[model samples]
Target: MATSSDSMLAISVFPSLTGAESVSDEELAKQSVINYVEAVQTGNIYESVKWVVDTRFSSTDEQLEQYKESLSSNPFSDVSIKSIVPASNDTFTASVELTRKDDGETNKVSYQVIKRTIVGRY
Candidate 1:
């Protein structure tokens, strides 16, 4: 089994603005963030990656669609949100904890945030 201190999870963050006002409740905002991440971590690629709202990340609509179709069959798992740090007024970076279903090893997934949504993964 692959075991390491770093999981090398590639969490890509995008630089797109949602333009929505920040939630006043910190805990609520955190939960909202967790919910977004968890949705993507479930690996419903079509539904998950669609949350990424950055043009630079998608490049083209076709690419995003293709990515969704390709990753849908790949193995993925549910994750636990360990920590979330606000990087900007709306953006946050979070540490995602997971146990590989295939190997049973624990690992962490870190990513840049795009506020109020799941950034994306590739």
Candidate 2:
């Protein structure tokens, strides 16, 4: 059975449902950011790239390929998605905290405002 997180991720990424079931753009954008963070946490570059609207992390095919290869040994240990706030109709600001696996250090955080396309088509 899929968990609530999984369900939310699906709803956020794929907004289409039965007729008359619609997801707001803000909700979609918020979910997309969450999905992106989850992808990064799992070290799945392909998944992460799926949610990116522009060349924030990579701009070229070669760079994307390199990112795919780098997922094998992810630098971060854990990721905590703090908040997803809507910036505009199709944009959201996500706050995330990343923890290094090597040391027991914490307190590191980042805020990323992502603009998601209708279907994230590049």
Candidate 3:
């Protein structure tokens, strides 16, 4: 009773149902670091904050304001991920090279990225 189009739709939906093609923890951690760095480089505070779960910022609004202020004071022209190494089961250490917009000086910094699932309210 299924057409070719129906078969194709079922094929695509099968992976989502089975959860067989899920991304690994290491890969997810690496991607989080990359996304965070990209967001910071582009001055996207909203996106940047989404990748971070720091206790210093009391609220989302506070984090946004702080990130915005920090970015304005010390902005980077470019950020490149040099390496990402697994530190633990769900944690990764990423080495990144950043070029300062003010003086164009390149500096290497390492960031600890922890992958946590965000619970969605439906």
Candidate 4:
């Protein structure tokens, strides 16, 4: 069994804006949030979670399995971003709901404030 700390080390946040101190535009923040959510819904289980999740959330592929297990154990297989708010120029927060196709029960899981370095927008 992996310790909590070990499990936490699995995810590695790639180089991307975290929406904290780096982004403030509601539209952009919201869009990014949308993109992140979309990526997960459309992406493979392993690759999808990496897009919006940080390393501290989980470690190792097995740990990620646990995450999947949690969702699978429930009824939701996909997560949808219901809303987003700009916490600050460097912080963007989103309220997301996880729903399962089988049960149709949506559970809310807050991903805290997503922050990131500023990436130029077209």
Which candidate leads the pack in lDDT?
Answer: 3
The runs of at least 3 residues in candidate 3 whose Cα sits more than 4 Å from the true structure, single-residue gaps closed, are: 1-22, 120-122
Question: For model 4, what is the alpha-carbon lDDT of residue 84?
Answer: 62
lDDT for 79 in candidate 4 is 64
Candidate numbers sorted by TM-score from highest down = 3, 2, 4, 1
TM-score of each: 0.51, 0.59, 0.73, 0.52
How do the candidates rank by lDDT, highest first? 3, 2, 4, 1
- TM for candidate 3 is 0.73
What digit string (tens of lDDT, one per residue) describes model 4 on residues 67-91? 5665466444766666666555655
Tell me how far the alpha carbon of residue 105 in candidate 2 is from the true structure, in angstroms, after superposition. Answer: 3.5
How many pairs in model 1 have backbone atoms within 3 A of each other, for residues 3 or more apart or on separate chains, i.e. clashes? 0
lDDT of 1 at 82: 79
| lDDT digits (tens) for residues 1-122 of candidate 3 | 11111000000112233363485655655666776777778888887776677567678898789889989997988877788787776566777788888888787776666655444200
Using lDDT as the yardstick, the better of models 2 and 3 is 3
Q: Any runs in candidate 1 off by more than 4 Å, and if so which?
A: 1-22, 25-32, 53-78, 116-122
Each model's number of backbone clashes?
0, 0, 0, 19
Clashing pairs in 3: none
Predicted candidate 1 versus true structure: per-residue lDDT over 10-116, tens digit per residue: 23332233323343433444554465556556655454444444343435466466556644543446567777776677556667676655656676666555434
lDDT of each: 0.49, 0.53, 0.63, 0.49
